[model samples]
Target: MGTAATDDAGSATRALIFALVALACGHMLSTLLRTIPAISLDLMAADFHIEPQALASLTSVYHFAFAAAQIPVGAAMDRFGVRPVSLALLAGTVFGAVASGFATGPESFAVGQLMLGVATSGMLMCPMTLAAKQLSAARFGLWSGAILSIGNIGMLLSSSPLAFVVDTWGWRAGFWISAAGGVVVALAVFALVPNQPAEHKDHSSPMAQMIEVLRLGLSRPLRGLIALALVSLASSLVLRGLWGGPWLMEIKGLTRVEAGNQLGAFTLAMIVGPLLIGMIDRRIGRRRQRGCREHSTDRRRHIERAGGGSLRRTDCALDDGGHGSVVAPRAGLVLSGRAFRRPSPAIAGDRCRRSDPQLHELLRFAGRRC
Candidate 1:
């Protein structure tokens, strides 16, 4: 048993290391592509003989494609696993970046940007999948934060190192370098990332999974979160991708290189914000727990006074006699007069009967909806 446990631990460690690598690669690819707009905006404007405002639309075009691809890519990862899908997307990155380097007109440039967006879409989901499958629940937050921080390093490099590369070899040449890096990372993913077992596999087809993701994304808390993410991302992209460069160039009267550096600083702040917020969340959660404990004690005293001393020690004692009180230790209270005891077998049976069909119908509807 000990040996088996040791082997499991070793396997988990290996998987985590590979996941970190995958995350790093994803970050690097995303940051590299993200920086391309900032780095190439001036060149694109000159090459296309368009105003900066028109050039800004190209950034929107890329983000539109990127955002659109995420759901489908996530579905594909769920159904097909990450390896082949990731490699294929990386190939798109390579093709798009290299091709964008040679584009002679705005149309071709926009098309190339779209292709890059589609490619980069894989980066957002695949790494997270790998991490979810490999890392322990306790380690997930740490690994996620670390992965994001590593990825943001690519954003940092994009400003300075990319600028240097562009200065030495021109902007088009810098893209060629990114294309080559994509190819290399794709190779690394193939070599290092472990294949997930087919247990409890998604029997749904790709189209079905896509539909389900869309449906789930629209439902309740998930919908609310998705809406928030979309709104936040839209505002962020507008500020960073569309306006950051122009704001620096026009408003601040800075050169492209200087503006890129300033934008890089903003990206760095984004990387830092998650960690800061996580710390705050932990502190707040602790404080809430303490407050909840105090409130529970106060409520228990009140319950004792009301001839319900039975509720004092029980974790989730439910009073069905019109008092409408359920007391939980750490979780929250459900203040209804209904009995909150564990369901009897008959009740469980009834619930299963009702829920199973509803669950099946929901899944079926989702499969059809998206």
Candidate 2:
């Protein structure tokens, strides 16, 4: 039994390592889809004689293709299995990269970017799906987060390193190098990835499934979140993918390398944002707990001394928005008051009963002060 358990653990470890390696390649390539234009925008504009608006639209076609491909790619993963779908997509991306490098005009370059976007759409999803299958549910989130963080290194590379490459060998040479790297990744994926099928097949077609998700799965709150994500992600992609380098160079009066360095700093901040937010969230939770306990204890002692009787403890809880009401008693009446916090307006008003007119007035005055 022990030997069998040990063997199983070893196998799982190996599978996890392989899955990460395969995903890393695809993720790095996907980052290139976002970063290539940032580093090479000037070269592209000059090469194709395109204006700023035209250039933005051309590069944005990548995001358009990526968004459009999601449903079909998810369906492909469900029905055809991950390995084949991923291989096909990654190969298309490689082909697109090489074609873009060799593109003679704007039309060809646009087509290449569209293909690249379509191919790279499944890069992150395929790996996540594979990880879900390979690891336990409890471990999935941890492993997936680690994989994504590692993949961000590609974004880092696309900054100063990419600038150096483009400066030394030219932008076209950079794409050619990426194509070569894609080939190497493709081989690694081919050898490492298995044809893992969905655990339960959804008989619905891709479009049908997508419609169902929109109708049933997306609640009002979820829809709001999706809209928020759309705005934020759109801004990030537009800035990092197209405008950042140019803005830095033209407006900020920085060299290409300096702009790249600034972009890298921006990417680093993005990477750290979630961690900082998480830490702050935990701290806020702890403070809220401590505040609640101390407030309850102090209020209860005051109420007991004033009323000359014991007070019953009532449960008070914050809503999702982190606002709540505290209930306590003073003399012969009950007092309900609210408190405010950051990110939302505070509550300060209080309500009391006329059972004790004088006490009610005093509590009302205290509430106003509170």
Candidate 3:
């Protein structure tokens, strides 16, 4: 019985890893879709004779599609399992890639990019959901981080490596390669990932559930986080996904390869940032609350006392029950250079383990400007 149990555990672990890897591939493609335009925009623009305004619209279409898909994807995931939903959507990525490879005009390219965005929407969320169902809560963060790190590898590849490909083989070839890889990733996901049953048996209409979720979001406590997330993420996407490369090449006067290398630093930070944060969060554990609070308060006080300038609207997130623990609000300052508004006293009283060590590192990295 002991031997049998060990064998079974090993099998499950392998299966879990396999599923994560397949999902990671999807995520990798997602990142590639986002980053490719950064590196290949010049080539694409030249090929299609795209004007500046059209180029901007073409790229933004992906984000538009991606954001629009979230609610419908969530509903589909609830009705179907992760496996089928993910696989089906992933095919969109493949289609988009191939279509873009052969695109003759800006309009066609935009359609392909939109399809890519829609198809790859489930990449990260579905895997995390799968982990929640299959693994322990303690392991969920680690696995999610792993999956994100793997996706960052795609971002990394889309930088200097993709630049090399575009330089040598032309940008169209790059799209074809991505399309082929997407097919392989889809097949792997289909074969290896097991179907997960719906977590909620409520059988409520998806529209109703979506409406309820939106209603819950109307709560005051969630507003600041939502606002912070939207503003910061939107700006980052505009920079990284759209204009970063042009700025580096034009303003900074860097070569294409050099620009790609610089962007690689951003991607590298993304890859390492979460892992380091997770480690810090884990180590700080319960100490996060009292220690982080004291440290932040005293540090801010000292800085101002020492003439460091008045601290901006620095906010700390106290824990809340029911929902998964959000990183302490101070982390937002560290990560995004913006402090969130503190939650209400009622919301703050609900406690969870502290996760501020990672925030400290982010603060330290970002410097006092945040």
How does each model score on TM-score? 0.72, 0.71, 0.76
CA-lDDT, candidates in order: 0.62, 0.65, 0.69
Q: How good is model 3 by TM-score?
A: 0.76
Global CA lDDT of candidate 3, please?
0.69
**Candidate 3 local lDDT, 31-127, one digit each (tens):** 8878787877877888888765578778888888988887688668767878988888888888998988899998899888888878888787777
Tens digit of per-residue lDDT, candidate 2, span 193-282:
765665535687777756644552153223333433444355457567778888788877988899999899977865565334333443
Task: State the lDDT at 352 in candidate 3.
Answer: 14
Q: What are the runs in model 1 whose C-alpha is more than 4 Å off?
A: 1-4, 198-203, 276-283, 286-370
For each of the candidates, give the backbone clash count. Answer: 2, 1, 0
Q: Which 10-residue span in candidate 2 carries the lowest summed lDDT?
A: 331-340
- Colliding pairs, model 2: 340-346
**lDDT for predicted candidate 2 compared with the true structure:** 0.65
The candidate that wins on TM-score is 3
Cα-based RMSD of the predictions, in order?
Answer: 14.5, 17.8, 10.0
- Indicate whether candidate 1 or candidate 2 has the larger lDDT: 2
Give the best candidate by lDDT.
Answer: 3
